[model samples]
Target: MIAIRSSVAQLALLFLAAAGNGALFVIILRLRFVMEQHLKWLEQTYPAGHVSARGEQWYNRPFLVRSLFQFMLFLAAFLSLILLIATAWTHRGEVFGTMPQDPALTYYEEHAARLADGYETLSLETAHPALLKLIDEHFEGETLAILDVGAGTGRDASWFAAHGHRIVAVEPSEAMQTIGKHLHPSPDIEWRLDSLPELADTSASGETFDLIVLSAVWMHVKPDDRQQALETLVSLLKPGGRIYLTLRIGPSEPERGIYRVSEEALNTQLAELSLEAKKLDEQSDLLGRSNIHWVSIGICAATD
Candidate 1:
């Protein structure tokens, strides 16, 4: 809304801003330094400039200009925040149960349901190369049975069958599973009418699996029951087997700027259970605007 620049940076930025006419600016050139110990070389390397920044770098700019602009931007943002707060206070009761439904996920689940309909054409489980590799390499003929925790349409189950593996898929939405089976045709994937937080009570799912997978479904869970949901998912995995999870683990308000999982805290939580974890893979898009952080399979065995 408004600009904030440091005093020294402010003066320089003003000049730059005038030149840019609100179109451009430049900042520091971050250098990544590495030490090659054996060769006894301390090598330093830096990119010439920021991705879009041009002209002199931030640290080299005038003090007052930088400060003024920095202060101005802050003030503008604060004013915007005030407006938002005022609006919220005026409409406090209206925010509850009125938060927008997540249309993106609805779209995703819908697609999954469609895939299930193409049961012969789409196998959700072994369809993804990454997931299938785990099945073939890690649990080959090892008594490992899989449970697709949020198995929307049973594509995963069908894939497991297509690959000669037995499987169970749990989908709470009846319409989705019905469409899924319609696509799959034959009774390949064992479908269950349950959801996360379902108990180990015999009256519940009534059984377990060698591996459990909860992929891209955590964020859809109601906030208060998420932990219980996690516990239930974990319980579904046999003590010596594993659980594969994929969730949004980044900045709390990533839409604003950036964030990542708390490394140490996530580790500590894993240490408390009968499981051990390793990050097996990672993928980034457009310089990590958003990333898919993969936590490798977590294995649990009985505590000695």
Candidate 2:
């Protein structure tokens, strides 16, 4: 009797899960169909000549090719839905409500050695010249207290420390921090494990800095967290302090889970935070990635 009850309960759960998946599948299929029909309508409405030169090519695909594309898209979507449902049911407890794994942390932890070696090989000579120049102009003092947020491998932190500045290198990944400490063993540079939207640990210490550098780090910050992050960083800035941000603009790095960022979007976020933008410079990707570009901005903590 107990065995029969257990089997019945399992069947009920499966049925419930299937029911949920059925609704989702139908919704997804409808959306796909609507999008396809809309695109087809647009093609017919505009015709080839009316379409822009760039868009004309898209509409010029052979009928068979277009049909094949649609079929492939539908098949992909169907398989994705099945996989999502199966995976969720297999790990329901962990997937339904638990926090998602952070890809950046995972990447750093898994590739710590390789990343450290890469950082070691990189020369400060290739550093963004505009950032360096702006730091020099704004920070007139001989020695400044600097905060290197997301200081992976401590490359920039070591550079700042070597230049006679007190450095606080904030890195959240233990593996990355370990490599950084090993590579840049400097008394002037202190390594701390803290992350943003909120630098809770770093903020608890009540320490502020004259200069804060977030190089290749701002892209990791999500859209919703931008304002809070700006506020937190602003609060940690000393009077007349400056911030240097270097953001990568392009598609996300799939492995690292870094998001694409734009200068205009960042400028808007900064304006909302009341931070004064001192400079915004655009540069080609330093690593020779043709699709990627860099935007460096210098901001000041608003003084009221």
Error of 1 at 101 (Å): 9.6
Clashing pairs in 2: none
* TM-score of decoy 1: 0.49
Q: State every prediction's TM-score relative to the real structure.
A: 0.49, 0.65
TM-score of 2: 0.65
RMSD of 2: 22.1
Local lDDT at 256 for model 2: 84
lDDT of 2 by residue, 51-117 (tens): 4333335556545444555565555556555755665564443344354556777677678898777
Per-residue CA lDDT of model 1 for 1-304, tens digit only, reads 0111122244444444444432222221111112123222322233343132233866645444445664564455455455555554533333333433233333444365454444445334323445556556668766557787767666566666676666777776556777767756445578776665553431265666777776545555655555566567666666566666554554444222222444354455556654466554443421244544433334354351
Indicate the residue-level lDDT of 96 in model 1: 35
What are the runs in model 1 whose C-alpha is more than 4 Å off?
1-130, 199-205, 249-266, 284-297, 302-304
